[model samples]
Target: MRILFSSLVHTGHFFPLLPLAAALRDNGHELLFATGSDNHDTITSLGMTPIEAGIGLDVGAPTAAEQLGVDPDPKAERSPEELVRLIVTAFADVLPRRFVADLEPVLAERAPDLVVWEAGNLGAMIAAKRAGIPSIAHGFGRVGDDDFDVQGAEVIQRTAAEFGVELPGGRGFGDRYLDIYPESLQGKRFLAEEADLRIPLRPVPFSKPGPLPAVAEGERTRPLVYLTMGTAFGSAEVLRTAVAGLSELDVDVLVSAGPSVDAGELTGLGDRVTVESWVPQDQLLPRVDLVVHHGGAGTTLGSLGAGVPQLFLPQGADQFIHAGVVTEAGGGEQLLGEAFGADAVAETARRLLDEPGYRQVAGRIAGEIAEMPSPAEVATRVVKPG
Candidate 1:
């Protein structure tokens, strides 16, 4: 079967879909990833074929910002409701029109058997329906409390009219919904009524395989903590602050500053602290006793998979919701706004290290993750539908 996997241009949006793509490919199914041209190299690096099929909206552009009505302040805090409204109204609703235009030609050429898309890529869903192919919605992390259908109704209606297809019902498009996080971390609303269509799969973390710094080589007498701001929000200031905070602890620290932030820009680090431009979380999480990071879906699920406690300093978007879920599950802590300072980070790190309950809950979640269906198993089900 020929399957088309679609996502937005960002790595965070695309990375979560790789494990299933690998599974399908390993089973001899043909696959092509469709996204913006910006992500072509990232897809190719993972040994998957990428077809460019979306517009790269410049969020920094005055026109774009005006269209979205978003505040330019990067540090401004938004409640989950406000964030979801902004995402749906400004970004999500507008992107699908361009995605539909970009994807139409690809759909005509490939004639795929199915379309597997990230949850937010509504254009893919529209294209799949138009092409008369089944589609599946793959989630990056825990589905939040927001009602996506209600939030995205206007966009859905407009896209449907443009594509000459009927709008999806209240449940939205997709024959199946693939949720990567364990049931415990999922929003209670999603689990309560929509569990029938939601399939649970273990969140397998993947990155562009590359040579990493030799942090795992020697024996360590103290606990190891890995700090990162992820790919999108990484800044030199965040790295310096993390280093300063964690340096006060007894544990050894490794900070990944991402590609945008230069490691040399960070200074005043003690002998126990190591800073790198990029370190794959999948590779480093095993050796980490605790993780301090922006509450990205990848990091949240990856830390749980590794059985490591986490400290989430969420910036915006679904990150705040993810942090809340992690805290509720007893696998981590969420520090927001003023609480997300150097002193608070260090104090939380100390408490998490001194406490064993966090690790125990993380272990339980890890065990649950291990028992969920593997990508290979899900792939078989995808091919031979029940």
Candidate 2:
């Protein structure tokens, strides 16, 4: 069977899905990995056919600040509302057009058996329904949350309606806010009224207990803490602050600055700190004792999969919500507020390293994650639905 796996440009969103795409290919199914133009090389390298889809909106964000020229490291600032507006404006109506324009050509040529869409791809789902193909929604973070599902459903309905696809009635809360979306999404109803367009969301396919990286033979043996603020927000100040805080303690620090921030820009770091732009969190998480992250979904989930305690410094958006979830699950701590100094970072690292409860909690979460199915198995189930 042929399958189309759609996602956004963010590596965090794309990487988690790649393992599944590879799994499908290995199982004798043809897979087309569709995403932003920026992700073309990465997708092809994973041994799947690549389709250049539309550019993605900044979902992981302080959306407004990012839009109106807010330098990532705002010397001093905080406004969640502006951030929300920036995110909504970028995606709502814009997402459908770009997604449809990019995908229509691909759907015309490939005509896949099924469509697998990331939660972020509102347009892909509509296109799939229009093409008379079955579509599956893959949940990446906190799939257990009911609120996210509700928001997702509303996004689907609003975006689809613009493309002439009718959504099942009965939406609540933020769903009503769809009216505030851009006017580009208004159009004729192309879908039949009775068509069952509701797609079931599948649990995240986290590969476990296999293909982990080996710890370096000469690796230093002090407590190891991995640090990241995510792809877009791992600012230079954050890196410097992390390095400074961790350096004071007796621990080995590995920091992945992500693509946006250059680790080289961080200066005056102690010898115990090592920085890189990218590290396979799936491989690195298990070997670490603690993780200090910006609370992105992929990092949080990857850390949980590895069973490592986290210190989440959520800057904005879903990070705040995810941080709360992590705390509720007893696997981590949410350090919020306008605090990003060496003293604050050091205290958090100390608590994470010296505390016994954090370790125990992480271990339990890791055990649960280990029980989840590999992405390949999940794809097999979806592709061959009974």
Candidate 3:
């Protein structure tokens, strides 16, 4: 099958989808990935065919920050409803017009067998519908909201609706994000069995299995701390805070700041801290003692799958809810009440390290994550739909 993949144009979002794309290609399917031009390099780097779409915000654009409504100051909190309103207006209102306008020609030209859309991309699914092709909503994280009525296709449909484009089906008529557009079937069968989608719980991105880094083997001698704030939210201050928290501990700290944060700003980092642009969390999780993160769905669940103790310091988005899920599941602790600082972070890190309940709960969550289908497995089923 020829697949058209559309998603949010950020490295973190695209990175997870790479494994699935590779799997489809290996299985003899043709894949074309579409996102903002900003992510072109990342798309090509992953060895996927790239379709350029002018539908993303510039990561370095000052206006982009204003558009996102993220206050750089950690102390200032946007009311949850206000934040929701901001995000809803941004993606559901502002983004669709631009996205749909750009996607029309691409849809007409590609005419793919199926559109594999990131649940957060807004209007590509609508374009797929416009092209009269079967489309699948692929979520890289938890699916929230019931609008547009299709399961998990929040970004796509909402963006389309904003542009006054009617979808082929009614609302509540397709798969939810987690289910990958199950509601849209109307009895149409899928290549991957629906039952298989349910078996592993959720899709996880991973590279082909390989040996761990040489340093990783010996690094396990002490408690291993995997510290990251995800690809989007990393900052010098956050890195400094993470480094400070782990400074006094006997643990080996691994920090991934993505390409966003400055390396020079991490000057005072402790000797045990290893900072990098990226690391293989799936590969490193088993050897780590605890995972401290900004509560992005990808990292939160990634850590959970490893069954490692988690300390979530959510800064935005659905992270708050994901943190709540982890806390409710008894998997780890939620660091609340303040923007993180070295002292507070250190204390939280200590709790995650020393608390027996935290470890036990994390172990259970890991078991749950492990049971989810790998991303490749999910894609195999989705592509080969019966």
- Comparing 1 with 3 on lDDT, the higher-scoring candidate is 1
Best by TM-score: 1
Tens-place lDDT per residue, model 3, 266-335, is: 6657678877667766788778888888888677766766678888878666677677767776777777
How high is the CA lDDT of each candidate model? Answer: 0.79, 0.65, 0.64
Runs off by more than 4 Å, candidate 1: 56-64, 68-84, 147-149, 170-174
Question: TM-scores of all models?
Answer: 0.92, 0.80, 0.80
Candidate 3 least-lDDT 10 residues: 180-189
* Candidate 2, position 28, lDDT: 87
- Candidates, ranked, lDDT: 1, 2, 3
Off by over 4 Å in 3: 45-47, 59-79, 145-164, 167-202, 206-215, 384-386
Clash counts for the predictions, in order: 0, 1, 21
lDDT digits (tens) for residues 270-321 of candidate 1: 8898888877778878888999988989998889989999999887556887
Q: Identify the runs in model 2 with alpha carbons over 4 angstroms from their true place.
A: 58-79, 143-156, 169-219
